[model samples]
Every structure is written in C-alpha cells, then in structure tokens.
Target: MEIPQANLGRGINLGNALEAPQEGEWGIVIQEYFFDKIKDVGFKAVRIPIRWSAHTETHFPYTINESFFQRVDDVINQALAGNLNVIINIHHFDELTEDPLQHEDKLYQIWRQITERYSGFPDQLIFELLNEPHEALTSDLWNQFIINLLEIIREANPERSVIIGPVQWNSISGLDSLALPQDQNLIVTFHFYSPFQFTHQGAEWVEGSDSWLGTTWEGTESEMSAITNDLDKAVRWAARNEIPLFMGEFGAYYKADYESRIRWTRFLAREAEKRDISWAYWEFGAGFGIYDIENDEWDMGLLNALIPHVLVFDKDASPQSQSR
Candidate 1:
C-alpha cells in the first residue's frame, strides 16, 4: 500500500514548443540559464508542459517521429541534470476537445502510445494524462472519460504516478467527480484560478471580462475566505483517499498587475501548503511568470514576500521546508 509522495516545490511550465522553439533558440528550452533563474529564485523543481500534436501528427496515436521524442527527452534530461525535480507530460494535445466527453478512439490511442513510450521515465518524471481538458459538457461525462484514461495509463505504468483532473477545465470544484485511480501512485490534480473575478482580471478569453481589468488579487478578506472554502471538497478527498493532491496549474495571468500577481501567488502557495499539495504555477513566462522572461526581470521583493515562505520552493532539499 505504499504511495509515491511528491516533494512539494515551486516550478514553471515550459510551453509553446514541439510546434517550435522560437527559431535559432538552440538546445531546446531546458537551458542552464533557465535553471539558474529557478535556482536563483531558490526554486527546486521544474514542470515542463509541452504540446505535440503538430509535430507528432505523422502516424500519431500509434507512432511519432524519433526526432520529436528525442527533442522532448533532451529537454527533460536538462532539468534533471540541474538537480531539479522534472515533470514532463503531453500537454494541449487532447484531440477534438470541443466536447471533452466524446470518448473518441483517437484519444485512447494517444494515451496508449504516450504512456507506453514514457513508461520507463524515472520516478521524478511524472506523467499528467492531459492538460486542462477544456470544459466537458457535463461533469459526469468528464469524469467517465478521465476514468478510462486512468485505466489506459495504469495499463502501461502500474506504479508510476500519473495526474488526472475533472471536466471544468481542471477547476477544483470539478474535481468532485473524479475517482482516484486504482493505482496507489496516482495524484489528483486541479488548476486553481478561483473567483475568476480576481485571478483573471484582464484575461481576454474569459467571459464577462470587462470589469476585470485593473482588478488585483487584493480582494477583501471575505473574498479570500469564500474562494478558499470552495476548495474544501478537493481537500477532503485527498485526505480521505490517502492520495496526494497536486495543484497542477494555478496563478495570476500575466495581464494582471505585478503586485496582484505576487499576492495571488502567495495565496495559492499558502493554501497549497496547508493541504499538503504540490503545485506548479501556470507558466514560466507569458501571462504567469515567476521570472519576467521578456524583460529578464522578476519582482524579487514580491518573490521574497510570496515565494520561499508561501511556497515550499526547496522543500526536499530546502534548508527549512514545511509540511501541511
């Protein structure tokens, strides 16, 4: 009955690749410089989420070119070499996502190939089944599809950990419908962007976003309490099932004010720690950034105020790591 418990830490998502890595950018994105920043910020882990459909479309769901797989492997090795906990997964590749519940054969084929291919990845290299499965038409449908996906992964990776989330695009509330995988190593994941009114203030893709601009994570005490309470179900489930929980994605979108972003990061870090959950903010650059990739600048003071303390950045090797 042993379960692989993930050591909590702060990390970023390496996105917009497999499609391409901004031509002339050598050696893929797992650069030492990126690791340096993560280390400089005192973060001890890195989560690389890559989208592969464009590159793997050739004989996909059954086969992918070696070049594509090699590219991804190289990036993963870089993070591991830096002594950072590296998590890589098939991101943004869920096909025909218009109706998340379609249960298409292609979807199963995709996982079958992917899980089989990456089945040998080391313990630290966790595999997330899919990323934000857009909103399934209904929770029931979403949950059922995820259940089957879990079976697919378990078939190839019995003990290796895999992460799964619910229909409402990985929202905590949607997590209610998920049933833990039979495998003890499975971790339930949900992205936290609760009370969208605050977190996604200026996010263009969100609905009714007019009044969201200029808004900050500095909502009133009542607001924070309200949002936190909404997560009670997810928290309770993790506690009862003895399955570790991970906030696979959560953060203040880049469009938000810097100060607000810092506050929101602190909020999630604090709440995550309280629940003994591992979390990775939405991204490394663009929108959600611990480091301002474009300007090569980061809100250091904000990092100080919100990071190490609020998040267990170096928990495992950290001088002083906390547990929930």
Candidate 2:
C-alpha cells in the first residue's frame, strides 16, 4: 500500500459545509464547479470534513442514511473527475468528543460503513478516520480508538491510504503523545493556528475573541520565528518516526487584517513546502477561505500566497511530476 504523498501537496479544506449539522446549514453546498475551481487554481487536493455522526443511527448497526451517502459519493466523484485528490474524514462528532465512552462504537460503525462503501474507489480517494480528537477523547483514548478504527478500515480497504491526526484538535504539540501502528499506508496530520489570538481573532466561536480583533501577524522576526519553531517540532517528530506529515489545516480567520492574512498564509505555505510537509489551507469559502463564493472569485492574495504563479499545478503532467 503506497501512500499518495504527492497528492497531499498544496491542498485546501472544504470546511463549514458537510461538517455542519447539514450540508448547507453553514452555507456551502459543495457545487460540482467547486472542484473544477479548486483544481484550476492549482490545489492538488481537498480535505472534505464531514460529520458522519449526524447522518447515522444511534443504535446497533448505526446505518448511515443512503441518500446522505449518495451525496457524499457525488462530491467525491466530482473531485476525482477533475483529477484532484480527495481526503474525506469524520468531522465534528461533538458527541463523541464530549463522551467517547458512550459514542465509541458509533464512530467505529460509521467508519466501517464508509470504508466498505468506498472500498473500490480510485487510489486518489483517501480516508481520514477522524478529525481533531479532543475534550473527553484524550490522547491515550484516541490512540486506542485509531487502532480500532484502522482495523475496521483495513477489513474492507486493506491498501488504502488513511490520514490520522493527534488529539487536542490536531495540535502540533500533541504529536509527542501520539502512538501509531506499524502501517505503511498511514499519514500523520496536525493543524496549525499558532499565535491563536492572531489567527482566530474575531471568531465568534472562541471566548474573548472579540477583544482579539485587529490582531495581526506581520511576518516580523518574533512572529516568523514562532511559526518556524512550532513547525520544526512536527518536522523533527516525523523524521524520527519515519511517518509522512500533513499540515491538514492552517489559515487566518476572515476578520483578520488582509495584509496580515496574506503574509501569514504565504509564509506558512512556503515554510511547510520547505520542510516537505504537505498542507491544506484552513478552508475554501467560509471564515478562512481562499475562494469567495459570493463574488465567484478567488481571494487572489491568499491564493497566490498558497500556490504562487510559478508553482501552479500542471494539470497535464503525471501525478508524480506534480509533487511540490
């Protein structure tokens, strides 16, 4: 089972859509054109965050709704049709995070069904067992849970590449505590929103974020060093463990100053590439998006910061050649 390490390069998250309580509840319905747009703009992959828990039954078997599965299948098909690698994951299972003991079996059942359903999908399609395990789902519990989920996945899709991240919302610091099985197809992921005050400023979900509004990352010596130092931790860990790393998410929120967003986004993207760490921007069309759905245009500043003109993905080339 070879990992699609190249496919993980230069990606963006399809956030605030399927991960919401409903597909459009958070305002993005994932139109087919979105895939074309993403691919055209030089992104090699898209990490789709889905809340499978919201669509499954609570009891034994925990069957996922057939229509919901079909909808997800359609999204994957669209992405593949455009030749973009797709990474789908179980996301925002808040109940599970709050009470893993009570919801553990439910999460397994969800993945069991997902893996079996997509068992025959193309290699470009990847599975991410879970997203950002935190709260009651501590590191020890998450490590064990990952083992259980991978067993379920391997039963149906033995050679498929799967992405797994550490706990504490996939924090880089959590990497030291993570434990993984000896599986060649696994890719470890972590999220970055360092200097959280700057990145998450004015995000309504965070307490006291209002006061953090106007916070900025100016690419100053201290700020740049902070990011470099934090990312180096993940780099060192991956080198020692011999596991490929993916910065599954990183971006400044919409309310952040425009120049700061560009500076931070470009700096991080380049740094990750320099370290050979593949990354996906925090989102596509919400608070932290590179694409503007309303204007039907890209936030070119951020877009250029991420892919850059010189590094645009060559759609006509072989997959291997497309690696950054």
Candidate 3:
C-alpha cells in the first residue's frame, strides 16, 4: 500500500467556492476554464474543499444530495482531465467536529457513500477524511473516529490514499498525538500558519483577528528559527514514525500587506519543498488565493512566490516553458 504522495505535487485549494454553505455563496463561481488555468499556471494538484454536511440530511443513512454530488464529480473530472491530482474532502463539517460522539455514525455513513461513488476513480483521486478536525473532536476521540472511518473506507476502496490530520485545527504541534493506523496508504497532513496573528490577521471568522491586522512577517532570524523548529519537529516525527508528511494548508489572508503575504507564502512553500513535503496553498480565487476570479487573471506576485521556477511574463510566448 504505497502512499500516493508523488501525485500531490504543487497544488492549490478551490476554497470559498464549492465549500461555501452554498456553491458560489462566497463569490467564486467555478467555471470550466478554472481547472485549465490552474494547471497552466504550474499547479500539479487541486484540493476541492466541500461542505458535505450542509448538503445532507441529519438522520439515519444521511444521504448526500445527488445533484451536489454530481456537481462535485464534474469539477473533479475537469481537474483530472487537466492532468492534476485531485483531493476531495469533507470540510466545514462543524456539527460532527463539535460532537463526535453524537455524530460518529453519521460521519461513517457519509464516508460510505462518498467512498462508494469515487471508489472506481483513478489513484490520483485522494480522499481526505475530514478537514481541520477541532473543538470537541479531541485527538483521543479523533483517533477513534479516524480508525473507524478508515476501516469503512478500506472496506470499499483498499489501497486508496487517504489523508488525515491532527486534531487542534490540524496544528503541527498536535501531530505528536495523532495515532496512525496499520494502513500504509495513509498520508499525515498538517496546516502551517504559525504566528497566527500574522497569517490570519483580518480574517473575520477568527476571533480577535481584526486586532492583528497590522502585523507583518518580516522573515527575521527569530521568525525563521521558530518556523524551522516547529516544522523540524514535524519532520522528525514523520521520519521516526515512517509516515509521509503533507502541508495541507497555509496562507496569509488577503487583508494583509502584499509583501508580507508573498514573503510568508514563499518562505513556507520553499521550506515545505525542502522537506519533501507535498503541499497545497490554502485557496484559489478568493481570500488567500493566487488568482482573482473576478478579474480572470493571476496575481503574478503571488504566483511567482509559490512557484519561483515557472516564469510568466508579458513577452514570453510560452508561459509554461519560460522559467527563471
């Protein structure tokens, strides 16, 4: 059961779009060209965040809406068609995370349906069991739930690469408490947003985020050391445990200063690459995105920061082939 990590190369998330309580509710409407544009810009994979709980019933056999499933399937097909690996996960499942005891069965049932639907898809399609497990879903409880859910997923699709993260909002520090299953097809993931005040500044959803709006990441030695130390622990843990690592999410909010955002984004991305850790930027076409959907253009600064080797210029006729 080899980990399908190689396929999850440089990537970005389709956030605030389909994952919105309602598709496009967050102002990003996914068009057919979005996938092509992402691949054209050098992204090798796309993480499709989805709010499956919002679309399902709160009862036995909690079936996901068929229409919604089709829509997701279509987007996934488009991504795969563009030659990019796809990661589809249950995101914003707040209810389950709030009370895993009460909703564990429901979670298992939901995965049963999700796994069955994409069970036949190619190996490039990875299933992230849940996103950012937090709140009452403590590491201990999350461990049990992950074990249970992995059992369900394995029953239907053995050998499929499944992504799991630590509890505490998938904090890197929490990785120490994450328990791995016997399955070798697992990829342990963590989100990097150290100096949360700087990364999440001005994010409306985070409490007290507004107060940190003026903060900036200077990439000082202390800052670099702090980040390196944290990531080093994760790296060492991965090596000691013999599990592959993935930096599933990391980004500075749009409200932050542009230079600070680029600095942090580039440094974090480069650091993750240095560790051979596969990663996907927090999002695309919304806050923390490299592309502005409304303008239908890439933020050249952020794009360059994420993939410094790929050069897109006004005079370069072949954007993909042009590299620094």
Best by TM-score: 3
Model 3 C-alpha lDDT per residue in residues 180-204, reported as the tens digit of each score: 8898788988998888899889998
Per-residue error at 144 for model 3, in Å? 0.9
Where model 2 places Cα greater than 4 Å from the true spot, the runs are: 1-7, 310-324
lDDT of 3: 0.86
lDDT of candidate 2 over 11-71, digit per residue (tens):
9999999999999999999999999889876789999999988898768889999999999
Candidate 1 lDDT, 210-320, residue by residue in tens: 688787767569867876776566777666677777778777766777776666677767876666677776666555555566556555534654465433333355533
List per-prediction Cα lDDT, in the order shown.
0.65, 0.88, 0.86
Return whichever of 2 and 3 wins on lDDT: 2
How does each model score on TM-score? 0.81, 0.93, 0.94
Give the distance in Å from residue 290's predicted Cα in candidate 2 to where it truly belongs: 1.5
Q: Kindly indicate the candidate among 1 and 3 with the higher lDDT.
A: 3
> Compared to the true structure, candidate 3 yields what TM-score?
0.94
Model 1, backbone clash pairs (residues 3+ apart or across chains), number: 1
- What TM-score number comes out for model 2? 0.93
Say which prediction, candidate 1 or candidate 2, comes out ahead on TM-score. 2
